[model samples]
Target: MADIFDKKPIAAFGEMAETGARPYYRTAAPDAIMAGCNDYLGLATDPRVVEAAAAALARHGTSCSGSRILNGTLPLHEELEAALADFLGCEAALVTTTGFQANLAVGALLGPGDASFSDMANHASLVDGVLLGQGSRHRYRHGDLDHLERLLAAADPDAGKLVITDGLFSMEGDLCPLPGLRELADRYGARLVVDGAHDIGLLGACGRGVAEHFGAMDAVDLFTGTFSKCFGSLGGLLAGPAGIVEYLRYTARPVLFSAAMSPASAAAALASLEIIRTEPARRERVFDHAERLHNGLRALGFSTGPSVTPVVPVHVGHAVPCLRMWQALHDAGVYTNAVVAPAVPRGRALIRVTPQATHTEEQITRILDAFAACGRRLGLVPERAEHDWTPVALARPKLTP
Candidate 1:
């Protein structure tokens, strides 16, 4: 009989040789540039955020010790929720121990006689949340509004409907077509829910996220986000109507069973939120870096598909070459993420790079130079004329929120 304790997958999963804060990592190649982090504003290591977290640690110790519904609710949690609701332009917000739980909490809203229409490329948490619910699930091709509309049109009109998508696709780095989604949701009498985990602190003029950027905040019924990204902390939040939030606060299993977010995380997120509100320049700087990096990579004959955000993916077309490219960059003092099979489609493997607002111009130039050299060495770079090198327009149009 075969052994039940098979561990091949675990063995294949390699560990990070070095880990540290954003933009740089101490490794064998010396000060390796960290291009895989999601800290868009670089506030994770900012003194103000650090100090706030430290103060909270001193005052409240560590864990909240119980679920929010039990003995764990804190004033900080309430304060954070209030601030998040106001910032995201929602009536109320509920904080969860992690972003994954926040999405799971949304599943609590689903039941029999309901349906969830999800984008195929949505984050795993969103996929899992749909699975957790009792609703019938329907998945459409990524960004395929026509397909989504077809699915919606075919569903029973009387059934409760939820249209779910990511505000910014983590791997593709493209913004969702919120305006179209809004129209579809309204036409179908469906509630629209956007998970803005990657774009909340970086996209809109007021940093509200893709919905705000596209003038569709009113179109969305609920918004979910995580502090682990631009907020420079840990925890997740779901914001929406006061009644819906209150409902999830009572019925969500993740909320009722999981421990409350630590005091330090709440304080750090609160401090980071204040910084995000006060400092618009950080948002501008990160976008500039993204454009610069995207343009530079394309100039070197590497394909960056449909990216307009900091999360740029360099398409390598296969898992083996993708891993080779990652190792080459890593050995040359540039660190990036190797996204392979299960995360993305097979033969669509790529290197994921994200730049921070705090990265210096020299650092950006160094990253470009490394890619240029590595691409040439790996024969990944073809003659400029041989490839379709048309640049993607990265400029954001001015808009008032």
Candidate 2:
């Protein structure tokens, strides 16, 4: 038989060495600026965070060796969960092996005659959670409350309903309207769930997430987040009322079957969480970097959609031009993610740029200069005018894995 993986799109896959927020790809030199990593607060390589992880590794070795429901439960896990619940203002929280599983566990709450209303542009994990559940799924246009309301109005009056959205969209770099979602969920007698994977440690006064950013902390019924982003570690968490969390603790397959988060990851996440709480300046610096980059890209005439978070998307229309621009930037010592196809709509490709708190003003200037030169060379932005480039409408291309 022909190689099953031969047709896979391996062009996007590559090996690289990462140190904290900076990545050293084989195609780029050591000094390449990483604008693609999700280490929003730059705590991944912090001495304190690293020390915590090292200590845990020395104490607990490598793996937890079992699921959280079994012998895998550790004191560190409980401590991290408690800290997370307290930080997010939830009554209880459960830690999972991965952020994807945390969201997947949401499906445990769904049953026959239930419904989940999701944003069209929600993360794949959220989409998969609904798919794995027995409940009916309804996806509204991204951030469109009217479409959500319509779907809610059409659902069975007695069915359990969940309105799920990402606190901050990873690819688009836009925040979900939490206040509006909360209002609609209340009006429709539905529970609201916000996935804060991309927002938790990078948003709000206390870094609680978009719910806290919009002053809708109590408005949301459930909150999910990943440690891989802002926490500078690997794991996931789901926080909510004690009763519901307890139910999933014993019931959700993702939590019950998967191996528990390693002790090192748990410790690192705890350290990072503490840092996020105490260091308000880190959040400030990240927001500053985001603003500078966004404004800089926009001023160079790139179409950066409505994004006010650290995740910024530079729209570059089709895949070919997007890859060309990415290559040009890579050659110029600026690294960014080249997002294309199914990650977005068929034709809406973009260069995903995420600035870290550790980046200096001088580095930000260099990044902007690289983008200005590369964008003009690739014809992805204007040569002179500061006006946003009008995205071309292209035919939908056939998608592949």
Q: CA lDDT, every prediction?
A: 0.87, 0.85
Task: Name the lDDT of candidate 2.
Answer: 0.85
Model 2 weakest lDDT span, ten residues long = 392-401
lDDT of 2 by residue, 304-354 (tens): 787767788998887667777777888898888878767888578888998
How many backbone overlaps does candidate 1 show?
0
Clashing pairs in 2: none
Give each model a TM-score: 0.93, 0.91
Q: What C-alpha RMSD separates each model from the true structure?
A: 3.6, 7.2
